[model samples]
Target: MFKTLADWLAFDVFGLTAESSMGESVHFFIMDITKIFFMLVTIIYIMGLFRSFVSPEKVRTYIQGKSKFAARVLAIVLGAVTPFCSCSSVPLFIGFVEAGIPLGVTFSFLIASPMINEIAVVMLWGMVGWKITALYVASGMVVAFFGGIIMEKFKPERWVEDYVWKIQMGEVQAIEQDNSLPARHRYAFGEVKEIVGRIWKWVIVGVGLGALFHGYFPENWAASLGDANNWLAVPMSVLIGVPLYSNAVGVIPLAEAMLLKGVALGTTLSFMMSIAAISLPELLILRKVIQWQALALFTAIVTVSIMLVGWFFNIIV
Candidate 1:
């Protein structure tokens, strides 16, 4: 059954009969649509659940201690398992700062949550190897933790707008006004609404781009990027990816397409990491909440970290 379906959805004229190509193209398109539909619904349901049980208040109460470095590390580990966006983490960021959790610690969570999200890592595991995926996740956490540490040491509180400080110190009233619903339903809806709202557009765009790549990328793209003698794929891809931002699920199809087209593993990985971790959206949004210096520092740190990750995997994988 699976073989038949694969044949129906992924036919190549050179590899299969004409009848199979027509059937497979239709099948592949349908599968793509189906994946998007289900993923959206699931994200909504999960986001709602998250809204019910967790909040800035709760997170603030828990994020304390002399072991801040360890705390930051823990946040990264836990964050990678979570499926949330960089914007949605604002509340937690506020909560941490309010709770006296320290600046670096808060940044740690912010960094890890968006960059090393579950969707990205899971996709990587399916497309790459466990070792590469593990490294990706690990490096993301380190970027957040170390980035936060560096920012904290520099003390960018002066750079933060007075408005963010005000919002951080107290209730963000806007997110709170909808307290009329039942707790369970409210939490579930909150999770879905917040997560889905932020990621939905990116998913659509990313998925469409990915599907295009999957369907049409020429062969030999990988060899061009992966050839060890050409070490620029990692940094070059990262630079190119800075303007783009797409979630893991949205980009996976593209990654698969790139592989099929012959894009180097190192270049592809770097590109994906840049899209996931260092996109223009993240930076622009972050500017509203953080100072220019902190934002620049954050971008620089993550960029270096991703490049390093790319280089390391290039050699090993």
Candidate 2:
């Protein structure tokens, strides 16, 4: 349906030849923008309905009472299932700190939350395949799990803002929620509005860039990076991704373009994960809660972990 519309607009309505780069780019842009937005609305609304039952406070409470390993696992699970992006860092971080969640557990949640959401999962499964999606999810969880453990080894509590320790979260308030189906529907619709509003511009930008890549890039433009001997590609991909700030909805289309243009899967995954997990904006937000030392260590550990995941997958797959 979307393809037919794109073709009619680009080739029939616009009277542009399919062979022309302009036509191809137009078709690509229209097709992806429509398809991705449709997916985003449908998936986010469903996830939001499920999310009405859960809250950030509930997440912190669940992790608070568990043993170290159990807490880490629970944190990672909650993080993956939750709809948070890296932009949610400040409030989530503060909540965990105030609740006295362990540094490692909090770190696990922080790492997984932005990197392994349901949108990313569905998008990957649809565009790439279930295998790559599974690998991505598994790698993200592994990185979050061990990354937190390693960060804890640094005794990161010392670097937390003194003010964070001083701010005591008062008694846990059980706010009453309307649990009727209409309320859930309203909540879901609200999420659709808020999330779509936040990411619509990014979706356009990402698809525009992707269209250009798909239409204008040389067929083998990324061939060198795809070669097994090019060890620099994975690290370079991560480095390039660190400064760019975009959610999975924005970056995944670009990633699909890269894949279509012959980029290696590991390098592409590394780029996507880096953008989702460790953007400069997220770091800046985190810096408000933790000192430079802890922030630096967190960055280094996660960066190295992502690089390793990329390198390993590149070798095996």
Pick by lDDT: which candidate is best? 2
lDDT, candidate 1, 235-276, per-residue tens: 988887866767666666566556556676666766777777
Q: Give a tens-digit lDDT track for model 2, residues 89-122.
A: 7778888887778898899888998899888799
Question: Least lDDT summed over 10 consecutive residues: which range in candidate 2?
Answer: 48-57
Which portions of model 1 show Cα errors greater than 4 Å? 1-6, 9-54, 81-91, 121-132, 162-201
lDDT of 1: 0.65
The per-residue C-alpha lDDT of model 1 at residue 15 equals 56
Positional deviation of 80 in candidate 2, in angstroms? 0.7
